[model samples]
Target: MSANKKNFQVPYTGVTKIQVGKKLGTSRLYIQTPSETYKFKFQFIKLEQVESSIRSFLPSSVLIESGQLD
Candidate 1:
């Protein structure tokens, strides 16, 4: 499953790092910020572990202070 779409919003400043994840065959969205972590089970099989794997492929998609969409 090659998910080529990344939808999120990272605050301007005072932000550290952002993370998102979702399970297979599901549209749930999980977010993890510096202050807290949240789970959003939009619909379908929005399991935690599967979403964890989706998040597993994130680091490489991370961007710096260059406004790069990655």
Candidate 2:
């Protein structure tokens, strides 16, 4: 043990990947950051809405190049 000097308080600057899937009758969104991965679940919204919301948070250049993925 070298005294745990790593800082865990830094904010995520960008999102690297986004994935959407369904499980147990609920829709799930997976957001991959440099330091961590986040998951969100929704039961009412359509898949397109979920994707749009995620893209809204990302940089416009990324969306312009590839658009949203399935």
Candidate 3:
């Protein structure tokens, strides 16, 4: 059998907004840039740590928010 692989990368510099929210039993992080929006789902407990780590590398101009997921 043969398999194909792909690598996906997103740079932080173009980040325009970051939003962390909880839905069901998991936490979700949404990252928005000029061209696309990326979504990540993780354990609810790690939300803060993930947010802080992402914030450290991003500029203050980037808007970060926390709220319930729609």
lDDT of 3 by residue, 1-70 (tens): 1253444456667777789888886878888889988888887467778678778987777778988866
lDDT of 2 at 46: 76
Please, what are the lDDT tens digits per residue for candidate 1 over residues 11-49?
434345543334454444434467754455546454555
Per-residue lDDT tens digits of candidate 2, residues 1-70? 3467653332334766667766665667876778787667889887667777767866665431223334
| Model 3: lDDT of residue 5 | 45
TM-score of each: 0.30, 0.55, 0.66
- Tell me the lDDT of model 1 at 29: 48
Name the weakest run of 10 consecutive residues (lDDT summed) in model 3: 1-10
Clashing pairs in 3: none
Cα error of candidate 3 at position 29, Å = 0.7
Candidate 3 residue runs with Cα over 4 Å from true position: 1-14
Per-model CA lDDT versus the true structure: 0.46, 0.62, 0.78
Candidate 2 global TM-score: 0.55
Q: What's the lDDT for candidate 1?
A: 0.46
